[model samples]
Target: MSNKYEEIAQAAIKLFEQKGYHATSVQDIADEVGLQKGSLYHYISSKEELLMKITQQSISGFNRRLEKIIETQVSAKDRLILAIQNHVVSVAANLEMTTVLLREALSLEPEHHTVIKNETDRYLSLWAQIIDEGVKAGEFKPGNSRLIALAILGSCNWVYRWYQEGGKLTPEEIGSYFAHIFIDGIKK
Candidate 1:
């Protein structure tokens, strides 16, 4: 990404996280990035466009990472856990981007929303397929693979809200815990 685009995205994330998408304006991001209002337009067309770009960029990064993970020939269980680890670790590594993705991504234009949603659906479907394979192999219990996949994704995605660096649970530790919960339900 160009430095200008990065600057604008970072500023928008901070503003969006603090004041939210509806309240933030292009001038606000421009002020945050030390650029004039007109100069901001040169880098981005509109505040919504900037929001979409930021969201799309984050989603694309995640898709790329997950694609690499899917290509690995690990066991289904191991692959699921690895996916959790990569998601958590990558979120931790890119905190602002992750926050933009989870918290502010929904406020984009309809077309942009569809693009991200489609990519997300594909990612979820891959996880569901892995879980289905595990169930067939007797490694996972019989259940709704799609719902289970959604639960795992939701559980992992929500961590960015409370997770902190150098906290009691590291990303790997958190990833393992999540994997345990997914593989074995909370029943005794």
Candidate 2:
């Protein structure tokens, strides 16, 4: 059950991941969607616009989902674990979209990249806040919380590169491993 725009967006994400955003043409996307090249424009303005949409949609979804998890009235350690699991599940569940978002974001125009960068910072700061909360409670060691958040995010983002749809490990399993490493290594 998908609308024309959703269909087009998904196709573009696949093409972007396979051929890259710079190399992917509207014609390529149109072909993938079995639409006449010109008809694709009826749905989307431009390829750059499509990239911006994909970039925005991907990060925005992550932000919303992660924000809800972080806002839960639970221990920072519990919240952090849930957040990590949520991150991995989202990435694993939407591999192509996530891949396109991660790999193609940098090729966006400066203005678009700036927006994505800010969204990214906001998302990562959720992890930092969790870490900071834990430190204040003396449940975790204090250091550079932002650095720790970035390291966790960096490690999780790597899932886009190699996570297979039918891989041996589940997203929960991968996320647990990441949470274990971060929490175990940092806990007081």
For all predicted structures, in order, the TM-scores are: 0.90, 0.96
Off by over 4 Å in 1: 186-188
Q: Which candidate is the best by lDDT?
A: 2
Q: How many backbone overlaps does candidate 2 show?
A: 0
Q: Write the per-residue lDDT of candidate 2 for residues 12-72, one digit (tens) a residue.
A: 9989988899999889999999999988888998999999999999999999998898789
lDDT of 2: 0.90
Candidate 1 has which clashing residue pairs, if any?
none
* Alpha-carbon lDDT, every model: 0.83, 0.90
Lowest summed lDDT across 10 adjacent residues in model 1 is found at 179-188
